[model samples]
Target: MITINEAYVDSLALNAAAVKNGRDLVKKNKITKRCRTEDKTLLFGDCQGSGKEPYRCSVDYLKPESPVYRCTCPSRQFPCKHILGLLYASAAGQTFSVEAIPQEIAEKRDKADKREEKKKEAIGVGSDEAAVPKRKTNKAALAKKINAQLEGVELLDKLIRQLVQNGVAGIDSKVLKMMDDQAKQLGNFYVPGLQNELRELILLIKENKDSESLYTEAMDQLTYLHALLRKSRDYLTSRKQNPELAMDSESGLEESIGHAWQLSELRDYGRVQAHVELAQLAFRSNLYAARSEYVDEGLWMDLSSGSLYVTRHYRPVKAAKYMKEEDSVFDIVKASELFIYPGELNPRVRWDDGPLRSMQAEDLERIHSYSRSSFTEVIKLVKNQLKNPLSDKHPVVLLRYSEIVVGEDDSYGLLDAQGKQIVLQDTAYLAHATTHLLPLLTPELAANQAMLVLFEHELSSGRLIAQPLSLVTKREIIRFIY
Candidate 1:
């Protein structure tokens, strides 16, 4: 039998109300008949409810850290109050006589085991002596695919040249429609990322049609597109010639042009395990014709490796709703080993199989030690990153800010000790600075306060903008997320 504690109960509850209601049920002795444990993995109980029959509750403790909960109660909340009550009673040291597993529970365990076995088999896990075979690749088929992609790139190049000749002022509804149509065509060639870039260019043109920097912004995007097209051609050629070249070796151009690596494949072949700090996080949702897209993005800094990683979780809006009710990726406010997907400059990662653990003082020290302290260093790094066509979101650390200037238009800017300044363009970060950071200042410090901040910086229309990750004042550190 597994020991369930209050910490485990709190983790399992949907919210504070659920915890209270479940504890109330347990205190009132609502749980009844046939409460037992089976195979040291399953716990079950009958709980009295308002209905004629008692609700059936069970907790599969096979994976104690991530228990599988089940109940017959008609509650939308996961695990329901009755399930929580059952676990609460078990945690309170209530003895459960050993019993044979019910057919329902047995079938569930069997199904779960079968699924796990199949996944292992797919990844070539057999007896210890068995060796996994290399995955077969059809070189001819791959060559044909690359050739088709190159054709799409050529078409994009022609469209870009035509747009430049027409001038930004001459672009109208018809031109915008043509670009949109061509972007859709690019998607047909498995280059959705490039298609996205094209769509963004069109949007930028439409939104800033009357602005003074319209021409500059349009040209910047066009230049980026041209570089991406050229780089993709080169990458594809090299990949076709040498199929053994590591795909995860920081092919920024390939990723920029929408080539993606399967997460399962990366986990099997190129996983990097480490403890990293989440420097920044953001979530965005968009409704399309048939479905909505939900994306969770995080900028993680590995304390041990001194490398930056970007982690993303995407789901349909309906599925996202369910996910929101549970712990978010940001909830892991601890130092724990995570499974990082492979990439040279900016890899992606996810939480590993363990309970979240808090960061130690040593972990914080390691992070501080690795941070770029000087403004000059930060500026140099930013300039170098901007040279990469796909370096739209490059991470930077401003170890200390010499001044925080609030502009007349309510915009904010930060000046480091070395006199380098960066504009804070994110409205959320500005609000956080005003509401949280400013109040923490002493009269003297407010006049000449030094603040530490982690941020992602990007160049837009010849201006640098900073999206704040965290701000450190004398009293506290505030993390901003949207």
Candidate 2:
């Protein structure tokens, strides 16, 4: 009777195997004799099991974000397959006849409601006198925690200053030991992001030892790390002075420096729930602490808001079963609404809910309009981001490149209508781009025509290097990340 607006079934399963098994059970008509509501606040069903008496499965959807599941089954897995099947069946639009709340279900709902009421009461919702003291206590505790974190930030600042003064060459012999010490210190301070950065720096140094551009790469990372430390310290100081200001703005620098926000906090602080289309998704592998780590980097475009969002999923490389297949990145996922996390110029988001759908012509047009920018505009944007010092990887659209030039040493450069050029940092990226863009050009077209491109770029030492996302000609768009 109740319309199911959202389904948390997929997210609730313990593992991928459980999800598949649960969905399989539902498809085989295993769940039968159910009761549901129009709001889908409650769902109970009988799922035929191996025994004669069916398993009684119930889901209390009173809290849509975190549904409570209960099933009379012997499965060790939480919720088990029956619970998943029931929820899946509801999400699939299978109608259930409205029925009176059974005695057992009614008791459980009443208990839940009472507990929530008590929680509100304990927070002094019914009495203003108790609320003031509770607020003060919470504020004091938060202040203490922030002050402790500030001490850690101060330590990090000192280490960064030393690194800058000594230079990469000075630390080359002891780089591994230095990184290990710094990472351990960062871990002590609960700065996981900085720790990860240190690990990445070590990996770069080790892998690129024989490369000609090793110094450039090392200095780039060191400078970025120094800037990050400075920004984090400044922000923490400001946050300490005005706690209210911290609540109002997104902690971009803080997050970049290893502060993490919970999913609940993100949901509450999100700016919008909008539909997004996937533009590019790739799996990048790297070494950390002598082990391989994998990260799924997904670039998504918000159709309504016209903003780009980055979604990342990280796992140990050894967990092959849990990792996404590289080729499967191109598979069409249904269009769904996402909770857009807060950011000033660029936002990050995660999937909220929706059915899978194919990208349409109108969707493409909207995305292009939102993302397209002239080369001059791109430069201006990068300049603005560079002002922050700690900001990295700003996505931009470069429109109408008059020429794609192959520079000395096989480097790639693109010239815009204004005669301004932006070069790519990687020679391989240039080779790949030339292969694709060259085929689309004829002798006359190569001489006179221009093409549009989308790229995520970084500013290093006053130079802008493009990391190509897509190359768009009059007839087709070829994505580089995929």
lDDT of 2 by residue, 254-287 (tens): 5676666644344444333444455432323333
**lDDT digits (tens) for residues 105-201 of candidate 1:** 8899899999989876775543442222345667788778777877887889899889888887788899989988897788778676777788878
User: In candidate 2, which residue pairs clash?
Assistant: 1-38, 2-37, 2-38, 3-38, 334-356, 334-357, 335-357
lDDT of 2 at 208: 50
Stretches of candidate 1 exceeding 4 Å from the true structure = 1-61, 69-133, 206-209, 241-245, 267-271, 274-292, 322-337, 342-346, 360-362, 398-465, 472-476
Error of 1 at 146 (Å): 2.9
Clashes of each: 0, 7
27 Cα displacement, candidate 1 (Å): 14
Alpha carbon lDDT of each predicted model: 0.64, 0.61
